[model samples]
Target: MPGRLQHKSALITGAGSGIGLESALLFAAEGAHVLLVDVNLAAAERAARLVAERSPGVQAAAFKADVSKEAEVKAAVDQAVALFGRLDVMFNNAGIMHPADDNALNTEERIWDLTMAVNLKGVWWGCKYAILAMRANPTDAARGLHTGGSIINTASFVAIMGAATPQLAYTASKGAVLAMTRELAMVHAREGIRLNSICPGPLKTPLLMDFLNTEEKRERRLVHLPMGRFGEAIEIAKGALFLASDDSSYMTGTDFKVDGGLTSCYVTPQGEQVLPPPASLI
Candidate 1:
């Protein structure tokens, strides 16, 4: 059988490493022409090479763009269409957490500003241009990739459940993503373009592992997970694959939680939680 994403083109931000890279690879494997977008040109190039190698003749490419910047994001979305004839899926997955985003009182103004700039504003820029690109144009219509596509914004499990782990800026930014995705989905549902958010639980990405470098910190997070382990990037990539394809043709404005049951459990075989959720920090 032909691949699910056959003839589709997908632009994945943050594709240099972690979930983005894995998703690029998986999308290519499923027959989507992949564009690996990253602020780091070299990293995007490296990932493009890997995606190309893994899926021969799949037409993988790389582009440099800081999604937070409007011009760069516009250029990337335009270039993806110009290079591949049309864009069919857009994955907005770049995000970060700062060391100083501990709590509302302790968080610095600079940290909150930077986090929102990159995490929230960045996603808005991507979606804005992606819809512009996906809107059926005379040329795109002739090419058969008419106005309609999937927009997958990466939110987090923390967006739904309050976490004692802190990272207030990160949490707030993701909450904004979930809200924006829902609103946009409703606004565009009749227009053919579908939008949704993916809420991944604690993953074994370099970013999270580096943050939890100490065993004490890792154990604190592990205890909250019903699976008793961090999720793998590929696992979340698979979830993106399902959304990118027509398999989710009826889905939109939904929060797909690929969280290893992390957000669902109240108690487990181990206990109620090695550490209780901090009593509502008044």
Candidate 2:
């Protein structure tokens, strides 16, 4: 049988590491030609090599692009089309959680500006260009492909709930992503483009691990998680895959939360330990 995303093309941002890198691998494994975009060209290239090694014969390439810069983002999208013939999925997954991004009063202007530039404005640019490309996507009858595609933006559980350890700018920027994704989905629904935001909970990714460095800091947050542990990047990548594929054909403008039940719990239950080991691609 053919893979779920066989013959489709995908472009993933921040493909150097974390959720982005894992998604690139998963997309390629599922037979989607993938273009991994990152500001760090070497990192992206390394990820592309991993794709080739792990999923041989799958088309995977790397490009250098800073999602915060519109020109670079546009160029990356163009490169995906040039290499893969069409853009079937756009994962706007590049973002930053600045170390100094504390509460509203403590966070500096530069930190807030930088977070929004990458997390909010970057997502906007990705959506803008991806929609344009998907609009003109050529029908590939042989591959069962057609115009329109899926756009998955990475938001956070913090976008819907408050965090006591406040990364104010990071939280705010994600909230904006959810909002922007909803409006864009509405605007492009008729055109066959589907837009949705995937809201992940606190994860064990480097981005959050660096912030929750101290044991005290980590415990402070872990106590609230019903799962009694942080999430993994591959878990989020699995959610992105669903949004990218035809499995979610009827879904659009949804705030798809793969948040380990963080947004729903008041007090986590304590019981026998049987949690599955975290998934990885490295």
Candidate 3:
């Protein structure tokens, strides 16, 4: 049987690690020719190797580029079109959260700039170039080489709800991403292209692992999570697959929350006044 993304082509940034890397593998498994783009050249190549191992003869390659840079973003998209003949999906998933982003007062100017540049500006550049490439293809009505494509941006649960631990810059950047996804979706809704953002909760990716390596930090996070666990990278990958495939034909500009019910519960059963038992205590 043909896969969901049979014969499709995709360009995914941050494909070297975490959610982006997992999604690249999943997309390839679904029969999409994936172009893995990342700032880390070696890591991207390693990911490409893993994909090749899983799906022999799979049309998946890695590209090195900084999504925050317009020239790099344009060139990366151009390369994907050049190699694949057409682009069907674009996953803008590259992002970074500062270690020092514990609170608003402690977040330095440099941290804010870096976070905003990569998280917000990078998404904008990816969308701009991806859309341009997709627009070059003939409209879906024509059914030509490029019949438009899907764009998936990565947001976070922090964008939906503020938490006690404040990463002000990260939160602000992601909030902009949510808005941008909606506006862009409207702007290109008639062009046969779909745009959406995925909002993930605390995930068990390498990035998160590095951040929550300590016992105290890990337990602290579980307290607020209704599911009492961190999300898996594969979970986010599944969300990307849905948005990238025609499965969500009518969906665009929507933010799919992959948080472990973190955003769903306003008050815990423990009561608003009473805090849930600590993860260790439980």
Task: After the best TM-score superposition of candidate 2, give how far the Cα of residue 142 lies from its true spot, in angstroms.
Answer: 3.4
Best by lDDT: 2
* Clash counts for all predictions: 0, 0, 0
Local distance difference test values of all predictions, in order: 0.89, 0.93, 0.87
lDDT at 21 for candidate 1? 97
Report each candidate's C-alpha RMSD, comma-separated, in the order given.
6.0, 1.6, 4.6
- In candidate 2, residue 90 scores what lDDT? 99
Of candidate 2, the 10-residue stretch with the lowest lDDT total is 273-282
Report how far off residue 115 is in candidate 1 (Å). 0.6
Candidate that would win on TM-score = 2
TM-score of 1: 0.92
Please give the TM-score that candidate 3 achieves against the real structure.
Answer: 0.91
Per-model TM-score versus the true fold:
0.92, 0.96, 0.91
- Model 1, span 1-282: residue lDDT tens: 678888889999999999999999999998899999999999999999999999997999999999889999999999998988788899999888776678888999999999999999999999999998878532344434566899999999999996657789999999999999999999999988999999999988888877777898888888778877788888899999999998999999999999989889864467454443224411
lDDT, residue 251, model 2: 93
Q: Write out the backbone clash pairs for model 1.
A: none
TM-score of 2: 0.96
Cα lDDT of candidate 2 equals: 0.93
Off by over 4 Å in 2: 270-282
Off by over 4 Å in 3: 138-146, 267-282
